[model samples]
Target chain A: MTLTKRIIPCLDVKNGRVVKGLNFESIKDAGDPVELAAKYSNEGADELVFLDITASDEQRATIKELVRKVASVINIPFTVGGGVKSIDDARNILLNGADKVGVNTAAIKNPPIITELMTLFGRQCIVVAIDAKRNYDLKENVNIFSENEKKFWFEVFIFGGKQGTGIDAIFWAKEAEKLGAGEILLTSIDADGTKNGYDVLLTKSIVDNACIPVIASGGCGKPDDMVEIFEKSNVDAALAASIFHYETHGVKGVKSFLKEKKIPVRL
Target chain B: MVSVAIFDYGAGNIFSLKNSLEQAGASVDVITSFDKPNIYSGLLLPGVGNFDPAIKSINENSKTKFQDFVEEDTPVLGICLGMEMFFEKSEEGIEKGFNVIDGEIVVLPSTMKVPHMGWNNLEIKKPGTILEGVDDGSWVYFIHSYRAKPKFDDVITAESDYGVKVPAVVEKNNFFGTQFHPEKSGDIGKIMIQNFLNVCKK
Candidate 1:
């Protein structure tokens, strides 16, 4: 049975503070991860995902501690990602009470990470995160373009969305699923901070092709954006950082809005 | 005391199933060894992961005690792989099941997706006591590739459409099975669980 998941509030943590930006740039301190997670949980957020935006390996201990703190007060399922590059890292996060571990760079670099994690922690514990940007071109038959291009469709990005892998986003999502990823967390680079709305077309491409749960991230300006994704795309959850961080919309607000739109959400 | 013994072979969603049972007001005891099934009012066999390994583990740990419990008319509930284990044999592995139900576990047709993971509506075939308050169209969460095809169609209590009549819920006296994850199906799932607990009470 396909019961819809409630809204999810994502917190990008760097050096123990919540930050938000487009394509992982122009960062601003949001707040404490523990405090923000608690607020959202109290406001009826169904789940919370924490991504440590830093690339340094030293932040591993800090992220694990952060996961332990957040898991203590938050009863809902929480997923921790960012800088998780190995099976031991995934184990430590799960041991710290994280329900799932999100892998992006590691999964891209080593496609076998999904199978290894699933073998150790089970399929439900592994989630593959995709950070994608539109790759468009004015020239005929060119579906992709370099970062210097003026018009682009959606190009897959890695390493905190700073480097383009030049791989098709749809192909990557499908490969990740085939590799035993239980769920796919799709973050649109184009809609990362515009608040205009999620790139519904980009989301549809991944969600339609993949059988696993696809989380719609980036470009969430209002509750209506969530409704549009749920109504139009096959996305299971709508993830946003700025809206929930800035208190533009609480978990309850989005749940009520989705419920009114005939979308199922846990009240 | 309404204690429900959850057989944990380290292969399934044991914690979530225990939590759901607890939420339904049933005291849940996760039993790793099948030495004593008589102590609990009911038993839950929840399975995840591969088939052969799961069957081997169950046999090595609690097969004798489980068979004895079923013989004594103890209420037992199986979910997903657990339901598949209730059949006579499985195609994934050469091993035979507990034979609690007259069926065989076969791989789903290749026409549909391998793992049918999603929410689909349940079509109530023969509404048993365990499905008392559940509406026919109520949806449940499912995640599995292999399913049991029972020789007796009357054994099916509820079925879901996934290119074929996938058995959503099955029953034969005290033995019950759910192909869907009732623990993850939210309120309706809780309701179905509560109904199963009611059967145990009788």
Candidate 2:
């Protein structure tokens, strides 16, 4: 089999501890990163991704230590991302046993960073993270966008979906693929932390357009949400942070649910 | 100690499989070279990614050694691409396989989606040691687009439905294969690995 549907548990780390937020607010420390990672690993997480969401300058050393600690216990593949800007940063994380390095802001600032990292460490090592929000024109009350007329645009955002770049999400996804990114972590800001469900239409737009694997992130409240994402979006993996970290749904619980739904997750 | 050699071609999920087998009461060694196969009580050929490069690497690095090792009727398990490599040839890149099994790997029809990623039910065709405790219609995780069409149907120990009779497990004496990721398949998968190690003990 060329590609398997990955069941990924995302850890949003701040100061070496797992944390979660509601709509990017009300941040609260969940638990120790290492302890949480071991728990998820035992629960059947196919892979774990730790996002150092804290600002870059303050937690560089702490994040490195956290990555090392998490890698020490978990045998499955783990990815470290967020605030990764330079090759040295990527090198340090991979040296700490991170199977992959996910780049977001750096990739947006200089798209060549994707190609550079891929050239240095192979295409399989680089994952470009895209956090997008669906733009709906209130006048039309529709999610559709018009490009050439310079009206109604589904613009892509950067810097944790706080800044809109007026770039279409579809365009950037295709461009990221062409730039040699191994995979795409597409998160919908519109549905993020809402726990309603994934932005299926937006996810499908990117998955349908791109040839590489697309990981659907955000808005996962339950295991069935994952089944819905895989069954409908054609995405290769589903990533959730709060649901797994808060013990709302264990990895084994999610895998069992998916298996029953015929969604094929690593049990 | 039940020594198990897990063949690593730099493509398969080596770490997870090693962890599972080690948990199943086996002293597992991840091997990239074919120089020594007799050190282990059994062999596991695990693979991921495309078939062409995987076959090329295995043949150039460990094919002859594997041939000699398989001659002894030692228990061997192939997972996913590893299973595809056992066939005579695969439609993917039209590459020639190990030819241990008189079968050909063909891609599933595109109308039903290419990768066929996810979990499905296994229909046991023949009971054997490898599937010692696995239920006949138990659900196992699967992630492949192409499947082996064994020249003889009797070789298939278990089959799964994905718009087709996909081979989930195949066994012939000491030779066995799994089209699903037993390492990723959770408790049931762990049991399956334990059963394979039980075979090694005998």
Listed models, DockQ each: 0.18, 0.09
Each candidate: RMSD to true structure?
4.6, 5.6
In angstroms, how far off is A218's CA in candidate 1? Answer: 1.4
lDDT of 2 by residue, B1-202 (tens): 7999987765423555776777677898877777654777788987455677676667688646566876756788888888888889988756688778888999887556545555566778778666888877665666566888999998888888766888788887678899987776656787888888888888
Q: Over the stretch A1-267, how does candidate 2's per-residue lDDT look in tens digits?
A: 123478888888877777887765678888888998889877778777888888667666777777766665665667789889898888778665576789988998999988877655545567889988756543332336544554453567788778977677788988988898777888888788899998787899889888767889989998878888988978988999888877677788888888888775544
In candidate 2, the second chain superimposes onto the true chain B with a TM-score of 0.94
lDDT of each: 0.78, 0.77
The 10-residue segment with the lowest total lDDT in model 2 chain B: B110-119
**What DockQ does candidate 2 have relative to the true complex?**
0.09
Could you tell me the TM-score of chain B in model 1? 0.94
Model 1 clash tally?
Answer: 14
